[model samples]
Target: MQKKALIAMSGGVDSSVAAYLMAQKGYDCAGATLKLYDNPQCSQPGERACCTPSDTEVARNVAARLGMLYYVFPMQEEFRKNVIDKFASTYLNGGTPNPCIDCNRFLKFDALVKKAQELGIDYVVSGHYARVQKDPDTGRYLLKKGLDSTKDQSYVLYSMTQEQLAHILFPLGEYTKAEIRQIAQEQGFINADKPDSQDICFIPDGDYASFIEEYTGNSSAPGEFLDTDGRVLGKHKGHIHYTIGQRRGLGISAPQSLYVCGKSLQTNQVILGKKEDLMSSSCLVNDINLIPWDHLDGPVQCKVKTRYRQPEQPATIEQIEKDLLKVTFHEPQRAVTPGQAAVFYDGDTVLGGGTIVTEAQLK
Candidate 1:
């Protein structure tokens, strides 16, 4: 029997090319476009939402040209519950969250994997800039960074389980963004020249605060801004508008520059302080998922990244509880915000990751 792959086409140049490449390899291929948002009712005009009608049409066209079967999976409710609600809840709880990570963990990897199994597809493929390889030494799957550093997306994929890594394919992992576009153009994919989707599909305006407010029907009322010494610095628009390391747009005029350092959902306060106040020596990570092995036996020396696009820093990962980890950076890291993922890396290989819950107990 021929090997099979369900290409997770996002109607973009990268995913389109990914489908073409997998088909060229003689694997039986099908295109699956996940309708992440509700239909015309949720569609916003002229915004870069990923799961709009146009995207699905583009994907269907690509599949037709490839002479492959196509599928449209409506995932509005699942996405809202697993990704969007979690996103809003995290922000309301005074922590920044990466919904893209959650989407991969809950949607593509979890939901789509089940769909692929139901359809008897051997692999679920996408255009993510990451690689999965099996280690010969231990006979386990390993997730590695894509060759293109500028477009490396392994940061958002740390929650991938070994099983998910084994059954998924990322053909674009070996190619840079320029190369992927070139491949798409060569293949005459309709979206070859289409601009990349930049905004979160659910939030067309990129105004997260407004979206959360409207979706949850909750207003982010005005709050007080407090200095490090508990002094009232000024009033803030709301806690949702500010984030760690944010300096601009703050109306307060202080003797020196100040940055947002923390938030208190309980007191409805946003804290401001000097840049030094943003630095964190260590943090506690929960909801752990390790790719290579089951658990960390002892303190493992590795590099860690607290946010996507931030350079990985040297750190030691230690397991404190079954589902908790402690990441201590060699040098204090700035703006290590809770609810953001703490992805650990052993060079290019993903060691595993978890959500930063709080600053580790200061000793």
Candidate 2:
């Protein structure tokens, strides 16, 4: 019997080629493009979007070329509630949010996987640049870094469970970006040269503050800019406009340069301090998810990344309290912000990860 697979086509070169590869391997395949967002509020009628009409067109065309069934699953409501609303609420509460993670957790992995199961699909395939492997010893599925280290997406995917890993396939995991592009070019895909979506798809301009305000229909009020000593430095435009370690757009001049050390919605204040104030030796993580194992009750040496795009740093993982993990970096890490993911890695394999809850409670 042919193995049935549902390929998530984002209409990018990576996903288009992923679908092509799966079909070439003789998997019973269907293509799906998740409509994650409505037309960008600010985009012109004909503008391209990550999962907009144009993107769906590209996916449909590719599916046609490959002679596979294709469909656009309208998941805008799920995306709005799980991703966009979560993003806005996080910012409102003085925390930076990673929407892509929410999208994957709720929409792709949760919702789409359920759909695949109902349709009798054996596997859900995506173009994420990460690999899912099975440990021969434990027989547990592991999420590993892609062959292209620079394009590795294992960090955001650490939330995946062994079951999710078991049913998911990443055809692009073994290929590099250059090779994916070459495949797309040779296949004569229309979006072969399309630029990867760099900005958040819904907020293409990258003006997160404005996007939040416009989307929520409520403006964040101006707040006080306070120095490390708790003295008023200036008035900030809004609390939502600043994030940890932000140095530019402060709209003020000081004797020495200052960075955003913290934000407080309770007091509506933005705290500024010297760059050195940003360094931290540890942080606490919550909402933990462990892969390849059940718990982290004991200490484990692993590489930890406090933020996406930052290289992993050596750290000791300790279970300090219920639902909490303590990570002590060998060197002081700067701007260990709350609300970001702290993914742990052992070699290329993801041990697990969680949301950063607070700075390490160093007494």
Candidate 3:
């Protein structure tokens, strides 16, 4: 009997191709699309969001073309609690949050994996640009960077536990973007030419402040923009409107350029500082997930990435507490933003990762 697999189809070319690949591999494949939200009537525009009713239609069409069973999983409540709420709360607390990571954690791996098990599926597959392999000696699954280094997504996936890695499949990990596109084109998939969704799917235009205001029904009233010394520079629309290291649109003209340094929830103030103030040599990360080894007994040299796209830098990772890691970078990293993930890598394999809580300034 062939092993059954549940393929998460997102109505995008990548995921549509994933479904095709899995079907061709002789797995009894079933395509599933997670409906995260309804058409949120944004005050800005009425155009349907990326994963809209039309997108679902496209996913179903692709599943039919692959001769597989299609199912739509209504995951709105879980998505709101796990992704949307966390996104708003992170910004409210003056930190940049990557909702895509949260979506993969709670929806794709956790929720969808559970759904797959309930259906007696042997594995849950997706189009993530990362690879999972098992170590021959330890018999443990290791998450590695995708073959296409430029499109590698291992940073967002570092939070995955060993068990989750054991059951998940990334069929596109070894394929270049061009190859995936060609596969979709050959299959005549409708989403072959679909433009990549750049903005936060919910906030299509990238106006996050407006989205938060409408979503939570809380008006983050305009507040004072303060310098690092506590002197008021100008008025900011709100703290949520700014992020660490943002320079432009401060609405304050000064002789020297200023960057958003910090935010004060107590005073409802946005702190501005010189560009030099954005560099940090150390950071504390909470809610860590260690891979390859259970926990680090001492400081270990590894390459660390403060943000997803930033090149990995030499660093020493130490397990400070049960759920915390202290990373000391060899060179000062710029804008090591809190609430973003700090993923550790040893060569191509993911060592571990955690949520950056605070960055320590160089003494």
lDDT of 2 by residue, 1-363 (tens): 999999998878888999999998999999998877664463422233476666778899999999999978888899889999999988887778898888888888888898899999999999999999899999999999999998999988989977788899998999999999999999999988998876677886678999899889998899899998999999999999998999999998899999999987778999999999999999888888999788866899999998888988999999887678989999999998877899999999999998887543221
After TM-score superposition, the amount by which residue 276's alpha carbon in candidate 2 deviates from its true location, in angstroms, is: 0.4
Q: lDDT-based ranking, best first?
A: 1, 3, 2
- Candidates 1 and 2, the one with greater lDDT: 1
> Per-residue lDDT tens digits of candidate 1, residues 55-106?
8899999999999999999888899899999999988877888999999999
lDDT of 2: 0.87
TM per candidate comes to: 0.96, 0.96, 0.95
Q: Candidate 1: give the clashing pairs.
A: none
> Backbone clashes in each candidate structure, one number apiece?
0, 0, 0
The positional error of residue 48 in candidate 3, measured at the CA in angstroms, is 11
Candidate 3: misplaced stretches above 4 Å?
Answer: 42-49, 359-363
Worst 10 residues of 1 by lDDT: 39-48
TM-score ranking of the models: 1, 2, 3
Q: What is the C-alpha RMSD of each candidate to the true structure, in Å?
A: 2.0, 2.2, 2.6
